[model samples]
Target: MTAAPTPPSPPPRRDAGRPRGATIVAAVLAAVRAELAETGFEGLSVERVARRAEVNKTSVYRRWPTREALVAAAMEGLLEEFGASPDTGSLRGDLHALAAPIAELAARPDGVALLRAALATTAPGDVRGAARQRVGPPVASASSIVDRARARGEWRDGADPQQAVFTLVGAIVHRTLLEHADPTGEWLDGLVDLVHRGVSADPPP
Candidate 1:
């Protein structure tokens, strides 16, 4: 007589074999950032990304379908993160809030590497454009920040919003990469103060 074998555990249910969507997306996006940080867009390899993500290449392809898509997905969170200005009720406080995160990122090894990678290229293609496409144009957020400051009588007469943001970004880059300095409390506070003076209603002497 033969014994029953539990029918193979009901074939493990229909969708059990499918990869978890959230987990898979997170892994793929993280892998995308890592690959982009290391190789920029030109050197990005699907195989390497898949290997790093611990996912099948098919999974990445099926979801993203292209390097641009992967980069876009990877940068989505950053889009939201750097897009909003906190209303701390003061221009100086708002500027500090805005610049704090970026400066903090520059202080980290992985972050500084990624920051360098962000400008590693200037060509038409590569991660440079993809990054710009995703993270920018940051003008909207900057404009809103300045507008708020203006309403509070804190904005300078002719200060450019884009230029203000650029200055902050440049200072952070120079401090972290060229100067090899930590963008810590005192340094960040000084940075905010400097930019605030430039962006405030006082003329430079």
Candidate 2:
């Protein structure tokens, strides 16, 4: 009888003992943020990110084919880490809470650099679209605060939610980017109070 054919070898487990996919993604993202913090967007590179993350460049390219996409993803992650919006049962308190973190971030040199670089490097449409999504949660929180204030008859009806939210954020951005000034706690409190007064004064529909 002919000798039995040798049994086929089992397929190699290429990913055996490797970190999970989600873990790898998180590592890459963390590396992206670290790179941005340390070097800003102009200095960011896929190879550097891969080295920092201890991940393969191919993996990053596979997920984010372009630098713009990677930057957008990194910014989105950063925004999410800002945590949930505050609901202190009053509009003024909520605005203060919202402005506090922004002011804190603006106070950091690295944070200011990151924001400026992101704004300067990203294409206009890409940055605006991605920023809108990234900022959506906080905007929603602001809207909720407005709704609560309206319910309590503290805020005017027909107040523009978008304008109200942006008023607070715009002040922080102006201080951080245009003036290159660190926002004092006193300044933040005054900003919230001013926006509250403006919104409160809107004529009712």
Cα lDDT of model 1 by residue, 1-205, tens digit: 8887765554332124675788888877877777765666667788898888877788889998886667656765654456577788988988888788778766765455456446666323554554555435344568778888989888988888889888887888889877989987898899889999887886436
lDDT of 1 at 74: 71
What are the TM-scores, per candidate, against the unseen true structure? 0.69, 0.66
Per candidate, the number of residue pairs that clash is 0, 0
Model 2: residues with Cα > 4 Å off, grouped in runs: 1-24, 38-43, 54-56, 81-86, 104-118, 121-128, 156-159, 179-181, 201-205
lDDT value, candidate 2, whole model: 0.72
**lDDT of every model, 2 decimals:** 0.72, 0.72
* Sequence-dependent TM-score of model 2: 0.66
Model 1 Cα RMSD, Å? 6.3
